[model samples]
Target: MRRRSFLASSSVLTIAALALPIYPARANEPFTEGQTAVLLRLVKDIFPHDALSDEPYLAVVEQLASAAADPDFLQLLREGMSSLDGAGEGDWIDRIEADRIAALKEMETTPFFITVRVSALFGLYGNPAIWSTFGYEGASYEQGGYLFRGFDDLDWLPEPLS
Candidate 1:
């Protein structure tokens, strides 16, 4: 009995010790499929781009994913995902978006939401694919500025009233 108890306790401690480092892996590692999908959905909800496809949006995800590679960030994201809570895959995106935004609003002043929101704000818009979707050909610094590039010709928008 003593030998069995000793072995069991030792095994449990060894297993726990082995598992300790795995909790906080580096942020550079690719996220699991479910995590990536959840993250992509989160980004879309935060910054909806109707004209764009999944490709461009995924680019934004990749940027955020790098940030999420940090264990701290991964924990933050996991918490945020949980905040969005148990909506089904079939649940309406609008409903999910509303709920998640509300959850985030609750944590608006916290570092996690702030970091995520700011990162998404900057990362999502800067993709060239997103720019083209909005009819922005990007900076013409070498060729001159927006005057020559027709900066105002935004194709994604409806024509203004006369």
Candidate 2:
């Protein structure tokens, strides 16, 4: 096969694999589509900075999906989503202004919220696709590590006393 076709096929497989529930799927809950969507929304809400696009945010979605494959973690997510769904007079995601704020405040300390929040903090910000937006060159280890790369290349500091 041509290199282009191979790459295309590989990308398709990768996406399909990501969409699949993690191995050893829980017999209960089983990570439904609504639950996954809720997780994605939760991650985006927690990191509501405009600098990022939805692409990098998928890292958080993937992490939460994997975690949900664990029965206990799935329970946390289910309950959190339950609380989230019941938070407002209408749907939590659709509540306007103060209503949305109130809903978020109510669920801020929930296990699902905390789990998704902590996971997104560690998992989302570090995605390489997110780096270039802020002029980050990413890890130096791959380029013979940071030492040879002159990580402390800043020249703005005043000269040290001789």
lDDT of each: 0.58, 0.63
TM-score of each: 0.58, 0.66
Candidate 2 lDDT, 15-119, residue by residue in tens: 344333333323224567766666667777777768887766766676666666556666767787788868768667666656766677777665455556656
* Candidate number of the best TM-score: 2
Per-residue accuracy of model 1 over 44-82 as CA lDDT, tens digit each: 766877887887557656766655555666776777666
Query: What is the Cα-based TM-score of model 2?
Result: 0.66
Off by over 4 Å in 2: 1-29, 142-158
Model 1 Cα displacement at 106 (Å)? 4.1
